[model samples]
Target: MRLQDLSAALSDLESNHRLRRRATLASPQGVDIVVDGQSYLSFASNDYLGLADHPALALALQQGVERWGAGSGASHLLTGHSEAHQRAEEALARFVGREAALLFGSGYAANLAVITSLVGRGDAVFADKLNHASLNDGCLLSRADFQRFRHNDMAHLEQLLAASAARTKLIAVDAVYSMDGDEAPLPALLALAERYDAWLYVDDAHGFGVLGGGRGAAAEHGLASERLIYMATLGKAAGLAGAFVAGEGLLTDWLVNRARTYIFSTAQPPALAAAVETSLRLIEEGDERRARLAQLAARCRERLDGTRFAGGASRTPIQPFIIGEDAHAIRLADSLRRQGYWVPAIRPPTVPENGARLRISLSASHEPAQLDALLDLMLQASG
Candidate 1:
């Protein structure tokens, strides 16, 4: 496209209230941050366990830098993989109860690697309609006979799986829906995968380090199986960088050999992996933090139950108050910002059309007074 055409397209996005902008954070990931020279009580981070700024993790990173330097300097197939990376991979495998695990640059890269490496032109891939964009992109890039069932509709998923005649079938879903804050019915999905003899791939990016006593949705639901491929990001609740895909030994080996993204991309910094090791230890023992987070979530839900900004049935920290119009959601977010709160306005294509919302991501680091104050602000703004 021409430069003028690109500018016109940008103008169209702005006119439709869909133009996205980046926020400059002048502080670390925490409940309080300085953004664009203004301080705010932020509720827009994915640091659910509040380990993003933990001292222990910081110390671990420093130790790692002293030992392994800052960067991996190459891809895993080359000299990039370090002892730190290997330890993290082994730790992740144990945490998720998988036979083997492989690290990737990010959750997106891991999903792309899994979907593309496992299935090809003659195979079939079934996905949830509300799966993350990365999952959808993986399906499309795989060149498989891709099919999307309705969101969380197991009956539809079963129907699709039963009707498919491909030599290989893969069912991909998110353990927890990012935007809606609801969980996938893993038991039912696993049964369907078994009945149809297909692989079940789950992206637990939002569930890991926050669910199942910090083991993630698979452990929370007791849905582990040989056919399950579990992928989780470390950047969210683990408060670190990168992602890992865990599965049986053969599958993990296949991904390491065939997944182009993993093969070609530079390995993540060894210092980050060392820090992630500390984060994992914290997550495993963070019962008090999780309990506090649950209390805070319940309080927020109860306070907003009868309000216009009520959220869905989410037991997780990701509570989203749906606002139908883009402008209205933006206005509410702006109002919250003006009041020193930093809940973000989530709009399409991040969400579906008419599903714009205020994505309130809670953290264990958030104080009770902050939650109460946010509830009060929400009521006032909605009114």
Candidate 2:
């Protein structure tokens, strides 16, 4: 009976065109790759700076393994923390202009640790409607009085803040919204946080290593505040695994002592930390890569002009092309895949209902010809 129920649910998902399928990648991440035994020019990766397969990063990772072996061997509080971890934390904090930073194995864990540890039942967490799923999960797990404002509606957020009587208030938002490829107004949100005496949490997963000269969105906005808790993932533009949360010294200490995800989970392999240290240097000096990425993004958007997909508002590498219906989105994805392009259709739950889209992720490694070709195919399919 239980199996039948589960199967029925899966069938519902399939019939509604909301079921997800994973394609096996038989090659390293980059612009061109093999998925499901077929080669494709992919616009589906988060490797924005084109460093995922770089020789320099590979060398650092190999060197780190030689020095630290493969694993940390225990949770951080016990014997897991190592010199490699310490050095990476220091470098991350310094790069993001914070006093300290704490590393986590993934962005979801980092968000969970920060949200759950910082607020509780009596506290209130204000969030944007379009925040990432990890953030939403954290808010729910925290048991905090969670309230969400309309997407980018500053006035609504302010209203919620003013009305909350909870002594501890937190405003959590994605610096750059993933599915929509839109950025939250950080400066404006910070002002509200200051006025309301609340903590402002900025999750810059999509902005770090690509925005603000590779210092991230806060640096992009020239924002530095004790009230701001900044978190970013290394897996996206950083072209590595894991995530980090940077802020005041006390926050790091508190998380070290209290964050359940940190306390209970084994530390990420120390070798990854050494690689991240190298990634930091590369990201800091990656002006040319960022410039190329910008040019590519601009060109992609410019080419979409005067089409049904015109006015692609994102200035970032993530450009979402809305397709309205689920089946149509799947068809478009199939069409692109058949044309040797690997753009996936983002459907319900990952996006709003009737807001299915092809999440066209761009990379600096992508040649202009590849992008132009993909865009032309997309326009043809849409037409």
Candidate 3:
């Protein structure tokens, strides 16, 4: 509890090779970043659309600041929620084909709001083994009878659902597995949920603004609004910040009333909400950007023809190259950094042990020459 004890714990983290370092980016987030004063090609960012440093977003932010000033100063139910927030929420609901939506300060907050609002002490929550940490934390906070099925295994989920004795059952999953870059068997999962008479909640943080013409995984699978409660973030492919939950009006209203995260946290800045609105517009209209990113991802996959890396099959922008061990993955990341590439090593706790990997995320702004150069480096490294 003391400073020295905290220092000792921090020292232990370094000794165990788990000390996290923050990278300072002098330039805006994009295909490249100026980290520690040196520019490097980036594969670590979630900016799949390459719109973070875009002119439109910049202009929108500037104009938004001029109109809305700075922070929201209080929680949504207080004096914080503005017209901009309402408009952004509405746009997101329409985009995801849901009846209504509610915004949260971040993706973590959105997950907390959804899970806690839906599941409780007597309720059961069945989740994927590999879902994001936010979802895991949400389950814990909800005080639900939390159970995890095998990753993407519907049979296991069904068995768990059949055995559950709770009054309400909630099936929680991610549309895209964050580290593995694989999609959930959404259609099968939805069908199973319906059969078991369970509510399905999907966190489409990675899928939204990247799949189904930027509508998300549920949309990609042609799953309707009634099939699931969806959550999406603006920080990923949308190139913005904050998150939202989209579903039936009653569910959203329930979240507004029951979700502690939404009730307690300070509302996001009105200017940021305005910026998110601009990002949504770009996402809805930028079909060519999405198409080009798909082509780029396919090309990159093709270039990795004969490598030891076992990246799972994913059509999304996130591509993982497994490195087996944490130390080796860190070393490879160091080597890549030395070579002016900015791909970071995904290590244990964030992922399972021996699942350390290089998460190569693509962007529409990546040039052909950059891809060729990266491929050449990968080939040399593989050899």
Candidate 4:
């Protein structure tokens, strides 16, 4: 509890190669950034559609700030929620085919609100083993009997569902695994949830604006919105801030009333909501960007497929090359940085032990020449 104890804990983390350090960004969130006064071709960001620095989105934010000022100044339940927020929530609900939607400060808080609000102590919550940390924390907060099925393994989920107490069970998963860049078997999971009369909650943070022609995983697979809860972050492919939870009216109403994260936190600035709305509109109409990005990702994977450093099977903008050890991953990332590419090292806790990797993220803004340069540097680094 003492500061000395905290320092000792930090030391322990560093010793175990689990300490996290911060990176300085001298540019806006986008395909390229300036760090330490040097420009780097960034492949470590989540701005998949490359709208983070989009001119239209910036204009919208500027106009919104002029109209709505800088802050919401309160929570939604208070006086914080503005007309911009309301319209953006409605727009997102319609985009995702949901009856209603509620905006949260971030995706992490939105997951916390949904799980804790829906599942109670006597209920059961089933989750994917490789789901985002927020969902894992949500289950912990629910105080319910938490169960994790094998990653993307529907059979294991079904088995767990069959043997569950048949109480109110909620199955939670990420539509696409963030670190692994693989999609969940959503159809199978939805079928099982229906058979067991359980609610299915999906966090599509990485899928929205990057999948389903930019509508996300549920739309990609033509799944309806009934008895299903979907949450997505705007900061990823949308290149904006905040998150939204979309579902039927009752589900959203319940969250508005009971979800502590939404009730207690200051609403995201109206300017951010406007910017996100703009980004969503562009994503819906920017099919060419999506296609180009997908093609680029596929090309990168194809070129790296047989290499010893490549860990293939990634179909999304996120690609990871395994290095087995933390030091090796760090070394490779450093080497890539020296070659002018800004790739980040993924270590344990973000990933599992011996699963350290270089998380290569692609953006629509990146050119073929950049990709070629990246590959050349990476191949040389591997050697």
All candidates' lDDT scores? Answer: 0.91, 0.93, 0.87, 0.88
Please write out the lDDT profile of model 3 over residues 1-383, one tens digit for every residue.
99999999999877766778998999889887899999999988889888888899989988888998888889999999999899988988988889999998899999888888888999999999999999999999999999999998888999999999998888999999889778999899889989888989999999999888899999999998475899999888888788999999998888889999999999998888888778988998889999888887787777775566534535788878877777777888888899999999888889887888778888888886787787677657746
User: What number of backbone clashes does candidate 3 have, counting pairs of residues 3 or more apart or in separate chains?
Assistant: 0
Taking the tens digit of each residue's C-alpha lDDT, what string does model 4 give over 1-383?
Answer: 89999999999988877788888898988777898888999999899988888899889999999999999999888899899999999999999888999999899999999999989889999999999999999999999999999888888898999999846999999998888888988888889889999999999999999889898999999998477899999988888888999989998989999999988899999988877668878999989899889888888878887887456547898887777788777888888888788998899888888999887888999898898788887777777
Off by over 4 Å in 1: 308-311
What are the candidates' C-alpha RMSDs?
A: 1.1, 1.0, 1.5, 1.3
The candidate that wins on TM-score is: 2
Q: Per-prediction TM-score, please?
A: 0.98, 0.98, 0.96, 0.97
Number of clashes recorded per candidate: 0, 0, 0, 0
Model 2, 1-383: lDDT tens digits are 69999999999999999888778999999998999899999999999998899889999999999999999999999999999999999999999999999999999999999999999999999999999999999999999999999999999999999999997999999999898778999999999999999999999999999999999999999999999999999998998899999999999999999999999999999999999878988898899999988888888779887777766548899998998999999999998888888999999899998999998898989888888888888888798
Q: Supply candidate 2's per-residue lDDT for 140.
A: 94
User: Which of candidates 1 and 2 reaches a greater TM-score?
Assistant: 2
- In model 1, where is the ten-residue run with the lowest total lDDT? 306-315
Query: How accurate locally is residue 26 in candidate 1, as Cα lDDT from 0 to 100?
Result: 100
Error of 2 at 281 (Å): 1.2
Pairs that collide, model 3: none
Find the number of clashing residue pairs for candidate 1: 0
* Model 2 residue 296 CA deviation in Å: 1.5
Candidate 1: tens digits of C-alpha lDDT, residues 70-159: 899999999998998999899889988999999998999999999999999999999999999999999999999999999889889888
Best by lDDT: 2
Tell me the lDDT of model 3 at 102. Answer: 94
Better of 1 and 3 by TM-score: 1
lDDT of 1 at 362: 86
